[model samples]
Target: MKMMAMALRRITLSPWQTALTALTIPSTTTTTTTTRPHSTLMSPPVVSLDLPDVWPPNSSHFHFPPPINYSNGHRAAVIDGKLIAEEIRSRIGSEVRRMKESIGKVPGLSVVVVGQRRDSEIYVRNKIKACEQVGIMSTITQLPDDCTEEHVIDAVSSFNVDPSIHGILVQLPLPQHLDEGKILDAVSLEKDVDGFHPLNMGNLAMRGREPLFIPCTPKGCIELLIRSGVEIMGKKAVVIGRSNIVGLPTSLLLQRHHATVSVIHAFTKNPEHLTREADIVITAAGVPNLVRGNWLKPGAVVIDVGTNPVEDPSCEHGYHIVGDVYYEEAVRVVSAITPVPGGVGPMTVAMLLLNTLDSAKRAYEFS
Candidate 1:
């Protein structure tokens, strides 16, 4: 490694740098930061701080630019996702009320689950309950483990044509006998609130094409970053894991927001080197404590999406949920982070509700 000495300012990303490359910024008052280059649209931008551009809490969005200083000064600010999600659900409830008054109906979501996996069952139950809490009508079609593919198709087909059903969700990890892709494809594109449809994903990846719905988890990751006042544009971001469900889409989302994104997966060499350079890090690798404190750029905004259950004899449940990041270590090193259970989890559910609300509005041609 070449040894050099230079002044390093705050490791925060710059919005203007990431927002649009073709447009030029007037040479004026701005804070500048510099970092190593990457193979992407931008060399690490020198961030220009414009504090007024930060969104006030009451504005259309939530933003609190960092370096965020808490009383203690060293530990990362834990993102309160449960609180943010509650705010989103409240907004959705108000919209549902308005739609009911104007159109005589509100949004509805249908969940199709096959077999009786305990984990899936709990997820479905929570989803249905969240729907109720947000004033969205929900239906669950429980099929047996031995159910035929035809039965699954029929259930999806029924929802596809139903006038009041605004969104269709197929609970994941279907029984071994079922054809997952075939079933996912059967859901109508218009009602695919889960956003797993091939067309939707394609729209997400392409410029000038807006997706009807973004996958909930990826969408949630972006939302957390935005809400927490973490800039995406012109920053270097690293995503661990390349699964379609979270990591791939999340990388795409970060790139779309103008961040240079690197995806570190099983095949990636010297993953820690790349990760340590990122201004933002999102890991969904599902390996407990896979990311340690040293694998992060100081002041980097981290959104941990992994929710791996590890054995915990002290706990009554015999296990506990932990994220890919080692929270204790990360807290002392990073600027901000989301806790395992309360972080991305609640946001995922909230986005599902919002997607359903959007689907209903689209269905009725309601603004």
Candidate 2:
């Protein structure tokens, strides 16, 4: 939990403190330094982007709880993951430099990407770029969409045995023909930086046990809550979706922090009813605009993990990224919410770096 230790240090910020500083500062304000133990994870001094412009029109069924007045007239404070990630990367760069100076070693990450899915490739590219920014050596093993399961497993296995590679990640959503579970299980537990190994999941699920590495996306979600000064202990949380990569682990992590968590999936009845009771909501269903305004409880803190792309012929890319929760409606109801592109997405990369660094620390016996 060393990486989590950094996040735990900042969970003490009070609601009033968050209200006062959350989104009050303008986007142009200079970033400020802090003495907090995990200050690097804190929301930056200024809002990275204005919410009203990025978010859509909103309405909420529950209004008993007064909204925190962000300076920009948005009811909810934006959890700017981009700025937070920059801080984390800056800190990691410093640590990597320190490690190299002290032990003549740096972390290395190997990614095994299968298939030509545009989203998967883009994500892998971002991961490689992030690794470079933090001084981690990264290598990518790309395979064709038609590659056999054994080919993907061999790719992961090679990295596992490579002493220089401290972390190994298998880019998700493998080809339909491949057995994903078998391939993931093939990764050595020690180098499973993506934390997909069954052992890691088991450790995460059990009490009095901790995984060698936590899954990055779930770890990032908690970091967002911590960095945003949202208290998790004793709060009601609802997680939509139950994928191993994000949802199930997120719900487990929330429970670790003493939150009462409910999970909603495709089979669930009255998903909105379960969601509205949560103080914190994390949606990763991958269905765009699945969680509407009425699904949220007033004053709830939301982390939108969904990154579905919607085609928009007008946009340059012809597609725009969006979260599972409807930004427009949820913004008005929730006291705090993370935007799709600028929220949990960046934190995921940051946490991956942290995990790789941690694995290197273990391998090198660096404090």
Top model number, lDDT: 2
Candidate 2 local lDDT, 1-367, one digit each (tens): 9989989886875554555556553343234433234455445434342232112123232232333333455578999999998999999999999999998999999998887775786688889999998899999998988999888888888888899999999899787799889999999898889898999999999999999999999999998899889999998899988888888899898999999999887645567778888899999887778787777787899999988888888987788888888898788878999998899888899999999999999999998
Model 1 clash pairs?
18-233, 18-234
Assess candidate 1 and give its TM-score to the true structure: 0.77
Give the CA lDDT, 0 to 100, for residue 327 in model 2: 91
lDDT of 1 by residue, 216-308 (tens): 999999999999998999999999887777887899888899999999875455577788899999998877787777677789999999877
- Overall lDDT per candidate, in order of appearance: 0.83, 0.84
- Number of clashing pairs, model 2? 0
In model 1, state the lDDT of residue 236.
94
Cα error, residue 326 of model 2, in Å, equals 1.0
Instruction: Give the lowest summed-lDDT range of ten residues in model 2.
Output: 50-59
RMSD of candidate 1 to the truth, in angstroms, is 14.8
